[model samples]
Target: MTLLSIAGGIVDDSALSSMASNASTRKTFIDSSITIGGPYNFHGLDLDWEFSSTTTDMSNLVFRSLSYPAEAMENNLDWITVMAFDIGAPTWKPNLTEAPAALYNPFSEVSGDSEISSWIRAGFPARKIVFGLPYYGYAWKLKDANNHGFLAPANGADITADGALGYTHIRNRIIGQGGAITAFNYTFASDYCYNGTTWVGYDDVKSILAKILYAKGKGLLGYFTWRVGLDDNWTLSKTV
Candidate 1:
């Protein structure tokens, strides 16, 4: 089933309007989502809810609006790809432009309250919400190399491409160049590198496999990567 993925991905008021209870909520989402193949023609929809840590998200708005039409239009959406990354340090710093944090750990303080959880709490089907794992990691300059705790203070950004180091870059460039690439507290299900000044926390084959195993145990819908080009060859993908 070739599903069309909606970009500018946020369940905004316009999208919520699809659930306005007045009329055409399904048509709105379907119209905006599928143009190449009319509503009934396409296989399904893939809700790409990105940048969604708004503290307020919904499913009733979409479920109530899309439920009936979903069946009629045969739009039993392929699955939802939740952007479950970018978890900053434990403490929120207003001035810090960037910080070090696990790119895909679900156990974080805010991970539970974000995309997947919010949607499910709002009543979206768990079996249809495929989890998202970042193929990249965020970098930050450590302020106190001595006290590198979960929420340790950071000097500034890590100054990498987009302030994020991809699996390819991390594996080929960072790992052996400065320091050994190693896993953090094993139980944490993440990896990191501290080459004196730069501290990078990202996912490697071990961590990604662990996450995939964890997802399988939970009966998650499936897995999806942020981008195919980010991984080193097929290291992460094949491992997962």
Candidate 2:
């Protein structure tokens, strides 16, 4: 059965109405959320709670309550896919330490912390933990053309989609057509593709494989991606 996962855990003013204030409302949401799938044989929900650090209400109330529904939903479905990307960034900007860097740095301090562990600590089962891989890179418009590497300063992301460029675009258009320099950081297990003044950070085949192996080692359920369409003809998908 094809299950369409819905995005959750976002507090756009409120998640299914003030879950913190109205305790009854929280249960109502939990009850009603399941009914959404009754008409259609959809698989499950993918809880993507992004940028919870941006606000206090997000961090406190949303943080305290967000996971309950996901744990509940997991029981109701065949599977659930949780987002596990955006764990690191090279944007220490303007500082000398910041330079051009990969979006998905497996060996970075943050990645080392392992959000997956946090979920398990929060009480989610590891077998249900479908880790995520990024099929895109974060781009930065350089503040100084020559100043580029891991943690380089930048004006900001150069492209739309939060300065993101997809893997397929990086492959066919940037590297293939523009002759970008593809370099790997062995220590960190990440990749950098620089086409002239523009620098992007993404996962290459090697980095993807490395992550998959790591996940397998941890006995993870499987892996998922933030995007599949953006991959080079689903090259990353096939490889994973």
* Model 2: per-residue Cα lDDT at residue 159: 56
How far residue 118's Cα lies from its native spot in candidate 1, in Å, is 7.0
TM-scores for the candidates? 0.68, 0.72
Q: Candidate 1 residues 1-240, lDDT tens each?
A: 566666454357544433444446656655666665574676766555443332233343334342223332224454566666666532344223222324333444555125555666565666776777778876667776654434556765565634577878887787857565454646455677666656676777776777688667656798777777998888888887
Least accurate 10 contiguous residues by lDDT in model 2: 94-103
Candidate lDDT values, in order: 0.59, 0.62
lDDT for 88 in candidate 2 is: 43
Clash-forming residue pairs, model 1: 18-25
Off by over 4 Å in 1: 9-29, 38-42, 49-78, 89-108, 112-125
User: What's the lDDT of the predicted structure labeled candidate 2?
Assistant: 0.62
